[model samples]
Target: MQINQLTRAYRYDGIDLPIPPHLAGDPQALRAYHATLYPAILNAEAIDVGVAGTVHVTEYRRAVGTKG
Candidate 1:
């Protein structure tokens, strides 16, 4: 997928593309994944995951935007 296309898709559907599995459990892994995946997703990136707790979308949205 091209970057522009991905951005348009995101704008319409609010879906961020995922990071690959090999990069899922590490901080640098997400950065590495971003290096590869961002071009395909127009610079969309994943934030660091919480290691000590579960993520709640409701709480997240109240704190941040819907893009997570």
Candidate 2:
């Protein structure tokens, strides 16, 4: 299935933030909006997970090691 046709969601803090229609194809916009709700997202990176049942899942991973 095409990416635009597949469902979109963001996984963070063990919760799934389903991407709304307005922010569907805009990764940066989605991140910005999600960051407002979860400040930790600012430091996190988006990790794309292969399609699952036609849904595109992206996980937000935060830095765990000591910052140098």
C-alpha lDDT score of every prediction, in listed order: 0.35, 0.86
Candidate of highest lDDT: 2
Per-residue CA lDDT of model 2 for 1-68, tens digit only, reads: 65457777789978998677888788899999899989999999899877888687899999789878
Residue 36 of model 2 has an lDDT of 91
Judging by TM-score against the true structure, name the best candidate: 2
Count of clashes, each model: 0, 0
Residue pairs clashing, model 1? none
TM-score, one value per model = 0.30, 0.81
Candidate 1 lDDT = 0.35
With candidate 1 superimposed using the best TM-score fit, by how many Å does residue 9's alpha carbon deviate from the native? 16
- Residue-level lDDT tens digits of model 1 in 1-68: 63321111011124344546665557455544544634432243443333323331110011234764
Model 2, CA-based lDDT: 0.86
Q: In model 2, where do residues sit more than 4 Å from their true spots?
A: 1-5
Candidate 1: TM-score?
0.30
